[model samples]
Target: MKRAAALTAAVATATVPLLALASPAMAQQPAKTAAVQTQVLDWLSLDALSGTALAQRVKELLGKGYVPSALNVTNATNPQYTSLWVKDTVGKVNVLQGLSATDLPKQIDQQVKSGFQPKLITGTGTGPSAVFAAVFEKTTQLAKSQLSMSKETFAKVNAEFTAAGYSIASLDVYGTVEKPLYAAVWVAGAATGAVQVTLGQTVEERGKELLAKTKQGLQPVLMAVEPGKLYTTVWSKGSATGLKEYLNLSKLTYTLKSAEMKALGYSPKILSAEDGVIASVWSKK
Candidate 1:
């Protein structure tokens, strides 16, 4: 389907001096668990795909050594998908889609019993009727996880879980005009450091928030939008050597900006698109 006409010009890029934040050492270490397989990932971004098409494309990519990193239904009403994939040698990854809220938990349990863990989970639609898409990797099970929770419930649990020495491993938002809900997976032995979550922010507001946070060495990890309406984002403290954002751009401008950013050694960390707008965060490779 044709997307809505292009919106305003792209927001200016935000830049900050390199900050010396300590990168996590655990991420680089080899996995000790029998289910764990670790390797470097080469990222790829894809947008404007339908459900059936995305399923087919994912199968092709998996054969070429890529796994899903992020996935969202940008336009739930029209049902367009925007996703990010990482080229890695992760063995035995399972991708599940179109699961009802009731079935998601059972599927997660089944996968875990088969020596897999949920790496990415996204919810689309609202309330009990919502459907989920998830990717499970052969890894140790998470210490805590929840799905299809309301905004208020998620915030409370997110705070409680963070205080208990767990960090959000995967998070996603669902619902557009109505109140949003969240799905998250948390793992033990990590702390949520310098985190920021934005809800119902307009494009301009989100751009400003993005600017302010990146300057303080924060990076956007997850971003979801409600078609032509609000946006939600999650930011966490990170090394901000070459952080930049291009917000609310038309398709043409997004293409132009992406090429320039690639030439400047920047690759996208989070990419969101809806109703003819493309907003993305990029960092130096």
Candidate 2:
């Protein structure tokens, strides 16, 4: 079960260029730090777990052990799957989980077009930091049943999105023991621009090529891998504004535990600690 616990962590604050555009809200007396690490732990825990009770599984993992620092994605892709990744001294693991706030499929497009209410979580953590949007949470779908596809299959999948009126922003295909069988795509809003593979490196001489690609104004938010598989997500400016943002996990704390850091000395700028997860950014005291 632990072998399935693949996850990812932010590439560190300096890696993302958009943090330069911190809204005035973050520039107050004490700047806010994004909750990056928290998300990583959650993503890892979900993969290490199995069964039907999503909440219980999460609870069990939290109690076992994890750091609370960063983001959480809501209404990601289809509720049939939610992405969570973690990394550490051992290795990197990314998970595609069939999870939801409620027991129905997530229609993310409709939610965005209508009204999107974020699911708020609370609990314990390392320190206190402001709540932030999960770095990148796109609509991702993993096959319900194992399936395989050819290079033509990629073309057909792209066509399906085009016909539906959405564009393919970024996608990574997965395979079983031999052929490419499953994939998850990050859908784009505009069909006009191009998602270019500007940066790339061969993962293996003949096996695969992992690259950093970008389109619109979005950046590659997360890159995760599990043995022979990989998953990546890219994003664009949601609002007309050109600014892009990503969470940086500054603190981590666990449930049934008291804050280990000096909570009183530092002034809190951002805070979101609930349901066994803790995220916060504090001002220099």
Which prediction has the highest TM-score against the true structure? 1
Positional deviation of residue 73's Cα in model 1 after best superposition, in angstroms: 2.2
Candidate 2 TM-score over all chains jointly: 0.31
Give the worst 10-residue stretch by lDDT in candidate 2: 122-131
| Predicted candidate 2 versus true structure: per-residue lDDT over 161-267, tens digit per residue | 55665554323333221333322343434444443221112223112221122224433322212113222233333221322221222222211011211222332
Candidate 2, residue 201: lDDT: 21
C-alpha local distance difference test of each model = 0.64, 0.26
lDDT of 2 at 160: 65
Candidate 1 wrongly placed segments (more than 4 Å): 1-41, 76-78, 141-143, 249-256, 273-277
The predictions' CA RMSDs to the true structure, in order, are 12.7, 16.1
